[model samples]
Target: MNWDRIEGNWKQMTGSVKEQWGDLTDDEIQQAEGNREKLAGKIQERYGIEKDEAERQIDAFAAKH
Candidate 1:
């Protein structure tokens, strides 16, 4: 469940991402395109959370999948 694996299987992973961040639009998820930084930025924008928090959530998510 490393970032590289997640990035490589991004299309399959999109569903999980949406489940974790229901506020994100389909377009925003697509914009991330498997980039951790981009996904964190989108999460930050939608949730009004700090960058660190967003990244932490992503880390947890990555660990799960």
Candidate 2:
């Protein structure tokens, strides 16, 4: 669940991310570039959720991956 590992494997992770947050466009995910904060922010924007909630979901997603 390391951000560094995700960042290093951003391209590979994109598909899973998209699968989890289907509302997000590819361009938005690309903009994240594997930064946890950016991805969380996007999830917040798309899902109308709080930042912490977004982080929690991302944490869970990363945990499974």
Candidate 3:
């Protein structure tokens, strides 16, 4: 799936994001608001992972969706 589709459907996607990154709070995901960079940042903060790893995880998630 394209990032554009993900962004366009952000509200619907939140549940999947929560399932994938359980550490992230709903508030954090809402704050991200479909921005890839912001979502990556939240994932990094919640998972204690590096930026690259966060982005990689996001890529995998996007691909799955």
C-alpha lDDT score of every prediction, in listed order:
0.97, 0.93, 0.95
lDDT tens digits, residues 1-65, model 2?
A: 68788889999999999999999999999999999899999999999999989999998998888
TM-score order of candidates, top first: 1, 3, 2
Q: Candidate 1 residues 35-60, lDDT tens each? A: 99999999999999999999999999
Q: Decide which is better by lDDT, 1 or 2.
A: 1
Candidate 3 TM-score, true structure as reference: 0.97
**Which candidate has the highest lDDT of all?**
1
lDDT of 2 at 35: 90
Q: What tens digits encode model 3's per-residue C-alpha lDDT throughout 1-65?
A: 99999999999999999999998999999999999999999988888999999999999999999
- Compute the lDDT of residue 43 as modeled in candidate 1: 97
Higher-ranked by TM-score: 1 or 3: 1
Q: By the lDDT metric, which is better: model 2 or model 3?
A: 3
What 10-residue stretch in candidate 3 is worst by lDDT? 40-49
Q: What is the C-alpha RMSD of each candidate to the true structure, in Å?
A: 0.4, 0.8, 0.5
RMSD of 3: 0.5
Clashing pairs in 3: none
Clashing pairs in 1: none
